[model samples]
Target: MEPEPTSQRTSANNSTYSAAGVDTAAGDLAVELMKSSVKATHGPEVMGGVGGFAGLFDASFLLSYRRPLLATSTDGVGTKVAIAQAIDKHDTIGQDLVGMVVDDIAVVGAKPLFMTDYIACGKVVPNRIADIVRGVADACSATGTALVGGETAEHPGLLGVDDYDVAGAATGVVEADGVLGAELVRDGDVVLALGSSGLHSNGYSLVRHILSVAGLGYGDRSEDLGATWGEALLEPTRLYTSPLLRLIEKLPGGVHSLSHVTGGGIAANLARVLPVGNWSEIDRSTWSPSPVFRVLNDIAGTSLESSEGTWNLGIGFLAVVSPDVASEAISTLAEDGIPAWQVGTVGTGSRPSGDFESGAKGVDGGAVRLIGTYRDGAK
Candidate 1:
């Protein structure tokens, strides 16, 4: 009998397994496009350039202090990337990734030294990679951190061509004695707060849900928010690290607890510093929130009573500072080109009976709580 056609047999066998979706050539193109932006951000501290098996940072320079404690934080941009993808904006997430991680590490009183990122995509696109790395470089330069390296994995089958995820690790340094947390927070110490640009990485799940109900998508400008939906949602996360690092360098290590405003917002993040039964009650009226918050609030129909337990609203990073230095620190941050503002003073409390107290208002007596916590719209 004639031998079975060779082509038919090969085709039959291959059809069962199917082709892996990732395009190898596409990954190469993506890497090539991002090379320029990547090199520009590299510093002498970076031992080997990008595309290495692992990033190398020679921290001998960081060993100047007798007791150097390394502060490392790993974070992702959260669901905010979804909004970005919706708008076809990929560059800003780079800054978002770096900002999110550095904010977390900085709270421990560490000066961010180096950062590495990981980008995973189902299908690699060159310009998209450029957009992301550029954002990362901007964040690194702004935070006084070096963009040492990162990973770009194109998983066609896993990530889905249109889907991607971004994450980063920021390593910083602080003297062993300089860690800030519940230890330095005391009653009447004053909770100095800094304002946020908008929804800075957290609450996007809620933001998306609310906007969906409102039959809205990003890019619509609402009179209440004063900007297009894309503008507010894509606002790059602010990094207090650069300014805070400079200030903490001169501080007495008494600057106290740092609350990074992220997934939890002000109430939840500040809660991390609660010592034993010590409660943190913030005044919601401390600083006027940006219009974007109001837009979300209106869309979510959120309440003050619920806010303390839910979102950051406007407060970004909370510096548990002494009453005297609070103003100066805030002023110093402003001088550094950061829009810093004092929102509330730290105090003891149980919980708010009436509301989440706003602005620089809250009592530190026993049983701490915000003055007004929205409860079923009663107060």
Candidate 2:
């Protein structure tokens, strides 16, 4: 072969790290695109701008509390990102990340103060990065949290260009005596089930598997779903912080414990917040499962027992409240646009005689079981 021109050879060789799949310039551009969104979430509490090496927030508010307790939670939007990638929709996934991380802090009755995110991808696509951050910023703003900082890592040889994963951590503050869960939950407390927006970022591995086996693609539509598979599945997780926080403030000590239903479903998660000698029997007949869940179960030939353990199956959160305030709490959530209902009640059970950790912060968890059949009617 004839020798190539020197200028052409030099130009080709000068491509630098872009040729290796990492683009430094693109990363900088991505930061620029998302800077405004990140800063938009900041209030008087956020001290520095977006490009800081570390996020700075004013903790002076903590001094106001009689005894301040800090609560932190970290989580990631699991394989659900695969569906987002498959459908080329990047916006809603960040909400899923917030739902996973920030909402966990809310379970302890904390007020979310700030959040940071981490995204890993083979390439830093500026617009895609902006889309993800914008969603995060929106959710943070709604939850009164500052989107202080984030890291977008380019993994050249690891993830594919379209492959990416997002995770985040959040910190919040509450009065020491105001901390929720096992310590506050008691017998006869009514369980209020908060409605979910959809799957809410869990059980996606099985979701993808079931769809794969059924020969369905993200673009495919079903008469049962009334929308594209991707659209139905990608419904952003409901932001429960605002309403739940309002309930806490309104009811005071009436709101005993809170549980964010996630990976292990209603029973396991609800169990995490119950006292050692107390148990809850959830009435499945209280509310009907959302259409998406019913469709998934029917198509996959999965039993309710199997699906409930993996998916939310409709309920996103549960609030264990005193019976006297359950009606008011449900009405309050309803007025806030969240459809909530009395789903069950707490009961006493024999405690196992030993000092042990109760899956949650050294507190003891009681037995929890889902009883009754699912109501067939849709809400």
lDDT of every predicted structure (CA atoms): 0.70, 0.85
lDDT of 1: 0.70
Pairs that collide in candidate 2 are: none
| Weakest lDDT window of 10 consecutive positions for candidate 2 | 1-10
User: What are the runs in model 2 whose C-alpha is more than 4 Å off?
Assistant: 1-15, 350-363
- C-alpha lDDT (0 to 100) for residue 81 of candidate 2: 93
Q: Can you write out model 2's per-residue Cα lDDT over 1-379, one digit (the tens) per residue?
A: 0011112223344367567666766777788888888888889988867765678888987778999998999999999999999999999998989989999999999999999998888777888988988899889988988988788878868899898989899999999999987888777899999999989999999989999999999999978888999999999999999899999999989999999999888888888898777877788888888888888888899876679888998899999999999999999999899999998888786633443223443445877777779898786
Clashes of each: 31, 0
Candidate 1: segments with Cα more than 4 A from true spot:
1-19, 347-368, 372-379
What are the per-model C-alpha RMSD values against the true structure? Answer: 8.2, 6.6
Give the Cα error of residue 36 in candidate 2, in Å: 1.7
